[model samples]
Target: MKVIIAIDSFKGSISSSEGGAAIAEGIKRVYPDAETVVLPLADGGEGTVEALVSGSSGQLRTASVTGPLGEPVDAIYGIMGDGETAVIEVAAACGLPLVSPERRNPTLTTTRGVGELILDAMERGCRSFVIGLGGSATNDAGIGMLQALGYRFVDDSGHEVGEGGGALARIAQIDASGTRPELTSCTFRVACDVDNPLYGPDGAAYIFAPQKGADAAMVEALDQGLRQYARAAEAHLGHDIAGIPGAGAAGGLGAALVGFLRAELLSGAELVLDSLGIEAQLADAQFVITGEGRLDGQTSRGKAPLGVARLASRHGLPVIALAGSVGSEASALNSQGVSALFPILSGPMTLEAAMDPKATAAHLQGTAEQLFRLIQATAGASS
Candidate 1:
């Protein structure tokens, strides 16, 4: 039997490649002669760079860039095997994890590092970009990133506005004359999953800033700033991006990418799957195995496993999902073409113990072995 393993990272436990390896090991235990193909997968978020790089046999490049708080941080991006496509996750440069809880101020964070990463990749001859817009630590409407790309945000006095979302309200002009000339030749595909607008009750600041350490007052202030920025962007860039779906993602980085970079916002899972050439791998597979850290109702909404299941279903292949933890809403995934769902846990244990990488891999292998045993028995009985 040809079994394809395309599992996502278990998040803090095993990576996508490791998860696939564990599943393959289990399948081997049940069917020693089985042909197994382990394909690493992600949804274009935290593991995007790693997934794309490993899956495509690409190389990872690291650079020193300004962090959300203006500190220097090392950020990594990937160049595909073709050497022309670069995959970047903005979180690598300006994610919330870089800031301590007491210092996690959205009003003060910036996305400057993201621009640096892009520029670095461009300098290395990458003309196409796949940027993952998730886990941001800023609410600046991407002004800091634009600044790094040579777009100046000037106040009424013609002086450049200071960094952070708090300063966006004072912007009076956007000067793009100094922007990198190479940007016009580049094409950007943004990995985005949310549909929030740029500003207002359901917008970036109101909905996401709180998690970035914004209180009620700060949220209001940031929202006003985004509104002001939107007006300036409309007048300067001649695009109405304020109400675009997904514009609020990554603290309005989605809007900036769309308006300024002319990027196409796509479902993160679809982007990752296409980039990895998953369809080609499913052609000869009899059964597919996929999973993630958790399986829930949200899994059907463009998560990696759902994408895998949908693809497998097209080929009439049964998809078995093994999640670290299965939620009450996991049943929703059944309609999405997942033939079966199983938790990797053997029995009740402390969350910490279960999350241990070695323990998690062992659990995955044991669970998969038992599942394959049942499948084999059922097939034998039918024969």
Candidate 2:
């Protein structure tokens, strides 16, 4: 039997690669001769960089770039096995992780560091790029990033707007004469999975600012600042990216990149699936196993496990999933092609205790073993 094991990260515990490894180990326990293939998955969020690097057979390249607050930070990107394409997760530079809890402030944060990374990779000869946009600590609508790329935002006084969102409110004019020339030769795909617009009730500031350490007043201020930035972008770019779906992603970084960098926006899960060549793999697999930190209503809408199951279903393969916790409704996954669902827990345990790396791994191994053994029995009976 051929078994394909694909799992997302357990979140704050084991990585997606580790989770896949454990599932494979369990499959081996029940069918020693079973052929197992491991493909770790991510939904273009926090673990996106590692997942792409691990599953793409990509080489990790590290560079020094500006952090969320202008500090020096080491960021990593991926050059896939083909060696011609590069994958960059913006969070590596502008991520919330780069700022401490006490220091988190969307008004003061910037995505300039992310632009620095993109420029560095382009200079190194990467022509095709996949930029993962998530986990940002900034709400400057990617102006900081564009500034780093040489776009000049000038105030009414003719002085350039300073770094951070606060300065965006002062912008009176914009110029791209100094923008990076290399950008014209590069093709960029922005991996964004959310549908939030740039400035509204469900948009960047109103929805995400508080999480980035913004109080109610700060959220209001950021929202207003973003509205001004969007108008300026429309006036300068001749398009309103702020109204585009997923433009609010990463605190409006998506809109910024779209307006200034001319990037194509795509769903992150779809992008990862295409990059990993999942469509080709499902054709030969007997059974497919996939999972993530949680499986719920959101899983129905292009989440990793859902993407895996959809592909498996296309090939008439049964798809089983595991999760750290299962919430919302199970029926949401039924129509999406999940044949079965497993929570990686033997029994009752605290959230932290249940998510223990070793313990979760053991549970995943055991569950896969049992699941395959049952499949073997069913096949035997049908025979």
Candidate 3:
């Protein structure tokens, strides 16, 4: 019997490979001779770089670059096994975690480091890019990254505007004559699950700035600033991507990428799964096991586990998903391809206790054993 184990990282607990290993061990207990393939899974968020690097036998390169508050931060990117595909997560450069809660001001954060990472990868001969736009700490509409990439945003006096979202309103001119020439030869496929427009109540600043430490007043100001930036970009670049889907992602970085870089925004889960070639892996597999930290209504909204489930179902494989927590709404996915959703908890425990790596692994193993045992029994009964 062949079973594929593709579990997402239980964030703050066990990693993807670690969780897969534990599940493999449990499956072995029921079928000692079963073939189990454990894969690293991610949905283009924090663990994307690590997952792609490990899954594709890629190498990680770290570089010191400008952080959200203009501080030095070490950002890591991945060069896939082909050596031409560069995988980058926006969080590595300007995530909320990089700044303290007290200093969390989206107006003053920057995504300059993200551009520097791209430049560094391009210098290394990587022309194919897979950028993950998630967990950003900026609302600058990606001007900071554009600046690092040699796009000049100048005020009426021709002086270059500074970094941060607050500076978006000061741009009167944009000069792309200095951008890297090699960028014309590059292709960018951005893993973005958000669908916010550039500016408005549903736009980037209004939807995401609060988490980056903006108050009500600051959100209004940042939203207005994004409007100004979009107007300037439309006038100067001659393209209006303000109302595009995912344009509000990562604080208007999506707009910048779509307008200037010509990036294709895609679903994070679908993008990662396609990169891993899930269809080919499931060709002869008898069963598929996948999971994430939690299974809720949001899980059905194009999360990694849902992606796996859909692919496996098409191949006529039963998909069992094991999650750390299973909400009532998760049951809705039963008809949507996921055969079953099981919680890993064996007994009640505190959140911290449940998050311990060893404990989570143990629960995963125990849950997998019982679930697979039932599967075996049902198979035997039918036979």
Using all chains and alpha carbons, the TM-scores for the candidates as numbered come to: 0.96, 0.94, 0.95
Best candidate according to lDDT: 1
lDDT of 3 by residue, 1-383 (tens): 99999989999998998999999999999999999988789988878887878888889999999999999999989999899999999999998899999999988999999999999999999999999998899999999999999999999999998989999988888999999999999999999988999999999988999999999999999998899898889998787889999999999999999999999999888888888777898999999999999999999888999999999989889999999999999998898899888899988999999999999999999998898899899999999
What stretches of model 2 exceed 4 Å from their correct place? Answer: none
lDDT of 1 by residue, 132-172 (tens): 99899999999989999999999999999989998899999
Error of 1 at 2 (Å): 2.0
List the lowest-lDDT window of 10 residues for candidate 2: 44-53
**Which pairs of residues collide in model 2?**
none
By lDDT, the candidates rank as 1, 3, 2
RMSD of each: 1.6, 1.9, 1.6
> Candidates' lDDT values, in order?
0.94, 0.85, 0.92
Backbone clashes under 3 angstroms, per model: 0, 0, 0
Better of 2 and 3 by TM-score: 3
